[model samples]
Target: MMKESVQADASALDGPALFATMSSMRAMRRLKPDAVPDETLEQLIQAAVWGPSGGNMQCYEYVVVTDRDMMARLAPLWKRCVDSYLATTGKYAPAGMDEAAYGRMVAAIEYQRDHFAETPALIIPCYRFPEPRIDEEGLIASAQALGPAGTEHLMNTQTRFQALAEGSCVYPGVQNLLLAARGLGLAANITIWHLMLEQEWKETLGIPEDMRTFAAVPVGWPQGNFGPVRRRPVADVIHRDRW
Candidate 1:
């Protein structure tokens, strides 16, 4: 009877414990260029594989690159893409900002613009399907799994919902990799710029034609201090039951 009661208490504690573990994982920036050891990286990969996948398909594939020559070769493409993003973003700059603040912001942007290749390691996550047609079936299965619906929605609506659900599975795997790195005293950030250059990057990395790149993550020990995260207030984001 005592053992049974203890087991019940342990089960009840699980949710809060999991939430606390997750909340403590802060996103880190300004990582040092020291390469993460091979064994440590394998542990992070193992953690990521445990993340949920649609139909347990485990469709994701990852390519880890630490080669100096390859990173140097790819650096120019990343710089060009980031520069373009910054140029476009500048059009939306706030009015009446002081010159000093504006200059600091531009400098920060420029630093990040050039730093991708300098990072110690880059991991590219990709997904592959047996065939392109399977994408449709996968979409349907993902949506129906969402929850009960009284009636079938339009195809467009279902597609959007399924994309969201599928994204949830893939991103958590990325998050697992990041958090596991943090626990091991490393820093990482997931970026999409490499995916933006998918064609060129795929050719350079020898990624198969069937694979689709999802994200690019740079990992290393931290070079600078972490700042507090800027976010909306908890009340703004949370609701008791429904909005």
Candidate 2:
């Protein structure tokens, strides 16, 4: 069941508002084996391309994988990574976790590992950079706007700031892609596990040497009812301007 908070939030939003649409941003795990139509997938990608890009560079590209052979080759690597993650994080430990929660995690991981090829569609998002170089002019402009001391502090954190800015641009496209899929009654998940087998994936997927994969997404129809998402209370994360 949807939580009271979620229902209230949904009710408070104006009909057709972006916030109401985004309220469905929960991770969907169980997917039916039915394939998403190619045309539908293309429409979703078209919507995703409308997302903002840093300096209008639009450095992103997406690769779709539907070949069973490729998915078969990639599944084992994901299994290993999933096992390692679960073990390291005590996902298998019986200490404080309830049996149902632990069992569900195990089952979900196993199902994903075993049935990845049946996902109907997979999308890999990649980013290409011209070359790795500091934006000196941008730095100078920011420094001039902020003055010497402020500039020094900003420059000290420039790398982190740049990464955050770039990721902000890219991740929204990912969200847009997912929402587009959901609007079509499809379920999907954005995964970083492909990073564990990045080299093999790049070789197999024909990813350009200059491009880097940022995320892998599996999309299909829902196999079961969607679960309510767990989250911290809005009061905990939201604050007035002073905060």
RMSD of each: 9.7, 4.1
Q: Whose TM-score is greatest here?
A: 2
Q: What TM-score does prediction 2 earn?
A: 0.81
Give the alpha-carbon lDDT of every model.
0.69, 0.75
The total number of steric clashes, by the backbone 3 Å criterion, in model 2 comes to: 0
Best by lDDT: 2
Candidate 1's C-alpha runs over 4 A off are: 1-27, 90-109, 130-153, 157-162
Tens-place lDDT per residue, model 1, 121-170, is 88887777443355877767756776445225545486677556557657
Cα lDDT tens digits for candidate 2, 175-228: 889888877778888878778778878988889887888888888888865444
For each candidate, give its TM-score against the true structure: 0.73, 0.81
CA lDDT, candidate 2, residue 118: 76
| Alpha carbon RMSD to native, model 2 | 4.1
